[model samples]
Every structure is written in structure tokens, then in C-alpha cells.
Target: MTSHPVRPVADLFAADGRLKAIPRRPARREALLAHLAETLFEAGRTYREAEVNEALTSVHEDFPALRRYLVVGGFLARTKDGAAYRRQQRPTGTGGAIPAVA
Candidate 1:
């Protein structure tokens, strides 16, 4: 349930479905990041740190940064112990852009 109605930035990706660059604009980046987040996870599914990283690896070799984007962009939530991650359930029209931290 995204306010965005669509990803809105398909041009940011390459033919292989990997991002060409991380957008500097939050709106564009967050939208694309949201799409990337979904590919790495399923709704209501919980993943281990390694599992999350493995999934993100499909998009970027810098999996850690991608993971951080998902977390910071409010697409995923992580435990303090850093063992698990979960896809967030956001309210429709909220745009899923709330940062998990600050």
C-alpha cells in the first residue's frame, strides 16, 4: 500500500534489474529503494542478517548500504541484536519513506 501508486523511476535501473545509481533525491531514491526492498523479501517474512544480505546482493555488491537504505527508508525493521530483519507494513499513501531510525 504505497502512496506512490508506482515506482516512478524505472530509468534508474539497468536491463538486469540492478540500479545504475542510488538517487540523491529522497523521493526518487526511496521509491526505487522500496522496489528493491520487495525483491529481497516477502510480506510478513522475517530474514536473518545473512539472508537479507544475500538477497540484496542481487542488486548491489555493496549489500550493506542497500540494507541500510531499506532500514533507513522504513521498508525494513531490524532487531537490536542485529540477528533478524522484517519487511515493514506501512499505511497506504504514506509513501513508505519514514526512516527506521531518526
Candidate 2:
């Protein structure tokens, strides 16, 4: 029988010595909008288009389009001044923002 060589323990350690797994969740449009709305509302501040884009940058680089989609989808409401958007409080009977994609 032939024997295989074994690797040393030191060789198995990565530079950081930590194994990292990427998150499996595919950031959905609706979830992103809901999270943004909740964060802004909790902060008691309105978010401008640029601010919204910046807020979502870590999740997706195409945040401008995503923001527009959220606006069109009714997850967020554009202010009358057209300078910012606000998270619309869901209707009393409504459950929550519908999931857009998995």
C-alpha cells in the first residue's frame, strides 16, 4: 500500500487563520428598501436621493436604479419637495413590504 504525505498544521492556517463564508442571502429589492426605510425612520431623518444611494452602496453599486425601483414599487414615498424620500408607514392591515426576489 502507498501512503500519502500529510500537510503540516502551520500549512493549513490561512494568513488570517480564519475561514470566512460569504453570506448566502441575495439582497432583494424590497428587503433593501424596507431596511433603508426602517433605518431612516428610526434615525428620524429624511434621505435624499444621494443619501439613499450612499446608504445602499455596500449592498449594491446600482443603488440609483434600485432606489427608483423602490419608489415606483411604493415601498418608499418621494417627498413633495422632490428633494428626499420617506419610508411610508405600512397600512394598518398590511403585513409588510412584499419580498421582491429571493
Candidate 3:
């Protein structure tokens, strides 16, 4: 069996003794946007750009584009200070129909 070379743990440590240069996978923009949209939709409420930005800070450092996408997609309504989003309800055909008196 061939022996594998192993680097010393100290070699990976930074001056502060923390692991240095550990790589992490980046978040997918599409997936992050979808999740944000779904979260807002399910909540049945609209959040301001700032609020949305704060909420998505973990997944996306830049939220301006995401906010714009949501507004354009009709998933969220935006305003200067905040936003108000309501689910689109289907109209019931009860207009002009008189109710029968029991």
C-alpha cells in the first residue's frame, strides 16, 4: 500500500490559530431568489426592500437585484418605506344575486 502524504494541522492554522483559507460554496442566485419569493408569498405579507434585504442577507449579500426581481415578477409589491403584498383572491359570483330569505 502506498502511503499518502499528510500535512500538519498547524500548517492549516492562521496566526490566530484559526483554520485559514477554508473554502465555501457560494449560494445560487436563482435558488435564493426563489426561496425569498416563496417565503414572502407564504407569509401573505409584503416586506420593504430594506426588510427583504435584511432577511436575505444570509443567502445574498446584495439584495437590490433580488428586490427588483420580486417586484417585476409580481411576487412582491414595493414602496419607498415598505411594501404591502396581498394574495390575489378570485372574485366570487355573488353580485346582483339576491339571497333567499329563510
TM-score of each: 0.76, 0.47, 0.41
- Candidate 2, residue 56: the lDDT equals 54
Candidates sorted by TM-score, best first: 1, 2, 3
Number of clashes recorded per candidate: 0, 0, 0
State, as a TM-score between 0 and 1, how close model 3 is to the true structure: 0.41
Predicted structure with the largest TM-score when compared to the true one = 1
Query: Across residues 1-90, which tens digit of lDDT does each residue of candidate 1 receive?
Result: 346543567788789988788777677877877787776689877789999998888777888888887876678888777788888864
Q: Residue 5 of candidate 1: its Cα lDDT? A: 44
Clashes of 1: 0
Off by over 4 Å in 2: 1-32, 39-44, 92-102
Instruction: Tell me the tens digit of each residue's lDDT in model 3 across 15-101.
Output: 764434322322233333344566544555644445666654544444565555555544455443444443222123434232221
Q: What C-alpha RMSD separates each model from the true structure?
A: 5.4, 13.3, 16.6
**Alpha carbon lDDT of each predicted model:** 0.76, 0.51, 0.44
Expressed as tens digits, the lDDT of each residue in 1-102 for candidate 2 is: 555354333332246642122212323334445555565444445667677777655445566765665666556667655577666664433344432211
For model 1, the superposed segments whose C-alpha errors exceed 4 Å read: 1-7, 91-102
What global local distance difference test value does model 3 have? 0.44
Name the candidate, 1 or 3, with the larger lDDT value.
1
Residue 64 Cα positional deviation in candidate 1, in Å, after optimal superposition = 1.0
